[model samples]
Target: MGEENLLPNKQIVLKNYLQGCPKETDFELRTTKVSTEIPHGSKGVLLKNLYLACDPYICHLMRPRGLSILSSHGFIVPGSVVRGYGVAKVIKSGYEELKEGEYVWGITSWEDFSWNFYPQQLLIKINITHDVPLSYYAGILGMSGLAAYVGWNEICCPKQGEIVYVSSGAGGVGHLVGQFAKMMGCYVVGSASTNQKVDLLKTELGFDDAFNYKQGDLRSKLNKYFPKGIDIYFDNVGGEMLDEVMLKMNINGRIAASGMISQYNLKEPQGIHNLFSLIEKRLSVRGFMVLDYKEKYPEYAEWAVKKLQEKKLVYVEDVITGLENVVSAFVGIYHGLNIGKRIVVVAEE
Candidate 1:
């Protein structure tokens, strides 16, 4: 290929449908190429990826079809490039809405370059006027942030003096949910699997209280800390945590169902033992995907930026450099190794 015609691309590909927890061997790095220019009259743009998100949903989608974890289109067929969310810089474009040098974030691949055919619909341009980092667009300002906003504003609106609890409290979405609960003047508590993440929730993210779920006497600890009972539960890690939370929910409590990282890879998912409590407490549980709440993005983006400027919002991320670390980083999320959002830096902004 001529120097002006194309560029080399490095892509992460799935060799087969994933089973159990994803391993480094489940994926392979392959080299390809992307066109340096969109064909004449085509509404396409070429992009160089900056940041990529490692979310549990991606892990769920990699499973065998019957075991696929999704309520919508989110699966990865074997032999295709693994799809992910990322921030990218435009290199060439024929789309009126996209221009060279502008940044965008949305559905991207775990690759160095992307030939985006629907940039106008699939991409949102980064605000040149804002001081927010490009990486945040893949997380705190992207689907994860929007999800937290919806979980609080639409799903579970906590009131002053009410008790709020979050499972997976230090994850990409859970940490933000806990913080948003605090912003609403509620008493917030979070449950993480490690003491390091527990400390992060209590100190860095401003949760009123936090605990390690893997520790001794979980029921006793939840009782001692949330003596009055939990009013709202933002669920991220499901399975046994949800069971315990259900048993401790106060009357009229709400549960914002996000994901079940603990149950994603299981051949057989665990069942909650306390369904009777839902009826007895008259509780409300709402589950939603990011796209289900797209109407709130503008409002959330504006509110989040204002909070960031006023020093009221804290955005935490465990950013790893290089695509080589993507597998370990993604697998680490299930092992509770990240303190906040897990991002892979495929390239510099």
Candidate 2:
């Protein structure tokens, strides 16, 4: 095929819907020719992916049929390509709003090349000059970052001196939540699975304090960390951690339910047996999806980007190179194998 007539190709496909934890073998890297020409009157652009986000939400898509899907979030159909947020550059654009060579972050199919797509449907044009790395737009400055902003600002609504605890504190969403709480002048405590993660949370990410949840005495540890009782709990791990946090929640406390990674792998999610505490403590627990807060993206992005420039924001990511390793990188997230945002670099900028 000639340059103007060449087909866009080179993609990763899901071998099948995963039944248990997704493994690297579930995806097959292959090439397929796709038309480079934008269909007549179509408002879309073609892009080459630079960075692809490997989020826990992708794990929800891997579940076998008949198992409870995570919140009706769509999964990768068998033989179809996996999809997620990514940073890409416009290679060809029939759409006036997107120009060639513009950097953007948005929904993208997992591939080296994407055919014509409505980039604006889920995409945001990005500036590459911000102090943060461009890949931050895929995580901290993008979806996962927005997840933290909404969960903290709209849902948790912290105040100065409030005690806030975040589970999985060193992760894509968790790390930001703890830091945002600190920015709001709250007492932030995070629980990580490892000592190194705990250190990153406390020292690098600016958590007021942190502990390794994989170690001893969760309830007692939280109690020891927050002697005054927690005013807000950002529940990411769920299950027993949520239960344990309830034991330490103060009256009128709030819980923002973001994720439940612990239960994602189990046939039956652990039940929370502490509802009685909610009544006695007058606590409120709410679950939120970032899509519900899209109107705030511009405001959040502006503020977050400012923080990044001021050195008040920290972005961390675990990156694995090559499209071939995308499957392994995604699966690693489930085992808490990555720090900060998990990204698969499929191609160079």
Q: For candidate 1, what is the lDDT?
A: 0.86
lDDT of 1 by residue, 10-32 (tens): 98888888888888888888997
Task: State the displacement of the C-alpha of residue 122, model 2, in Å, after optimal TM-score superposition.
Answer: 1.8
Clashes of each: 0, 0
Q: What lDDT does each candidate get? A: 0.86, 0.85
Per-residue error for 92 in candidate 1, Å, reads: 1.0
lDDT tens per residue, model 2, 257-289: 998888877777789998899999999999988
Give per-model TM-scores.
0.96, 0.93
Candidate 2, superposed: residue stretches over 4 Å from native? 1-4, 64-73, 128-131
Best TM-score among the predictions, by candidate number: 1
